[model samples]
Target: MEKKHTIAITVEDQPGVFTRIAGLFARRSFNIDTITVGKSEKQGISKMIITVIGDDRDLERVEKQINKLIDTIKVTEMPKKSAFIAELCIIKVAVQDKKIRDDIFSYAKIYDAKIIGMTDKTLTMYLVGESENIESYIRLMVPFGINEISRTGVTAISKDW
Candidate 1:
């Protein structure tokens, strides 16, 4: 049975490194659910948090392949129970009437989402939370009509030692 897996990878910061990693995924036929990369604490190195869906054997094979890459320094699987995971979502919802606007604002407050911007016709909200919370908030706004959504896919780190 397949399951979701989040892998944290540390690699040397260099051109073509992302391409190589992406190519590896494509070649192996693994679909990446989300990938977030940024500079790590160490200079000249970068970290990537990638989420994928596959069985244990498949995940093992992919990790081994990633470790073979020249730029790869370390690859570690972050189990949800042992990781602090989050995703960011920016959503613009249509504000058609006073009641709708009030309702939307109320829902945002309930979810602790920030109202980043607003105009006569729309309200833009910024929310950062677990994937499930993000999805739930989006669902609540559907009745109000969503104008646009931009999500920074899952980024995570291991829990405290």
Candidate 2:
């Protein structure tokens, strides 16, 4: 069965690190759902949280290839129960009428979204939640006419010490 996997990787903070990691996924033809990278708690190091949908065998191969990278210091597949995951999305919708704006506001409220930017013809919303929750919001907002969308990808942390 194909399942969502979040892989956490720690690597040295240097140039071309992202390209090297992304190349691994591209070479394997794995569809990357999302990838988030940022500085880690340790100095001179960086962390990456990659979300991909694939079967167990594909995931194993990805892990093995990632391990071969010289910059990679550690790699771990986060367990479902032990990880707290979240993703951020920014969506701009076209709303020319009051009724459409009101309807969008109602839906955003239900999804705990915030109206971050607004203009006469467009409204931009910021949402932070699980990947599934964000997808649901995107589907619901499609009827309102989405003009643009930007996602911050996935970030996860282990719950246990």
Candidate 3:
């Protein structure tokens, strides 16, 4: 069965690690849904949180290829039962009148979104939260005329410690 898998990896702070991983995925025809990489708690180390939708075999192949990379220090699938995950999104939508802008503002407040930019006909909002909230916001803003959107794929940490 194809399902979404969240894999977290700790790797050395070395160049080409991302390229190598991305190349591996491309070679294997694995479609990455989201990938978030950043400096880990320990200096000189980095952590990557990847989300992919694939079958068990496909996921196994991806995991093996990533582990074989020289820069990869540790790799593990985030346990679904005890993981806290979130995504960041920025959306710009057209707002032609005060009533429409006010409606969007109300929705933004409900979603804890911040108005980052505005023009005579548009509003840009920044929202950091679970994917569900972001999706909901997008759905709500569609009626107001979504002009653009960018999303930072899922970043996660295990709650189990």
Candidate 4:
């Protein structure tokens, strides 16, 4: 069965780290849904969070291959029940009138989306939470006028295993 997997990797902060990791996935023919890299708590190290969809066997193989990479300090596969997943998204919607703008505000309030910017005709909002929530919020905004949408895909941390 295919399902989503959350992977966290601690790696040396050096050039081509991401390229090599991405290359590995490509060579293995794995499809990545999202990958986010940021400075880790430990200096000189970077943490990468990757989300992929695969069967148990394929995921296991990928994890083993990732661990063999020299730059990789650690590779952790997060259990669905033990992971806290989130994504950050910024959406811009066009609102040409007061009623439409107010309606957008109502929706934002319900979703806990913050209005980060606004023009007479456009509203820019920032939302951070589960990918499902963000995606659903986007869907609700679609009928109004989705001008632009950018997302920092699934970044997750595991609860103590």
Could you tell me the lDDT of residue 55 within candidate 3? 90
Task: Tell me the TM-score of model 2.
Answer: 0.92
Q: What is the C-alpha lDDT of each candidate?
A: 0.94, 0.93, 0.90, 0.93
Model 1, residue 50: displacement in angstroms?
0.5
Clashing pairs in 2: none
What's the true lDDT of residue 86 in model 3?
89
Which digits, one per residue and each the tens of the lDDT, describe model 3 over residues 40-147? 999999999999989999889989989999899988897577898889999999989999989988988989999999999999989998887899889988888889
lDDT of 1 by residue, 1-161 (tens): 79989999999999989999989999999979998899999999999999999999989998999999999999999999999999999999999889998998889899999999989999998999999999999999998899999999999889997
Stretches of candidate 4 exceeding 4 Å from the true structure: none
Clashing pairs in 4: none
Query: Which candidate leads the pack in TM-score?
Result: 1
Error of 3 at 37 (Å): 1.5
Backbone clashes in model 2 = 0
Question: Which candidate leads in lDDT?
Answer: 1
Stretches of candidate 3 exceeding 4 Å from the true structure: none
Q: In candidate 2, what are the lDDT values of residues 71-134, reduced to their tens digit?
A: 9998999867888899899999999899999999999999999999999999999999888899
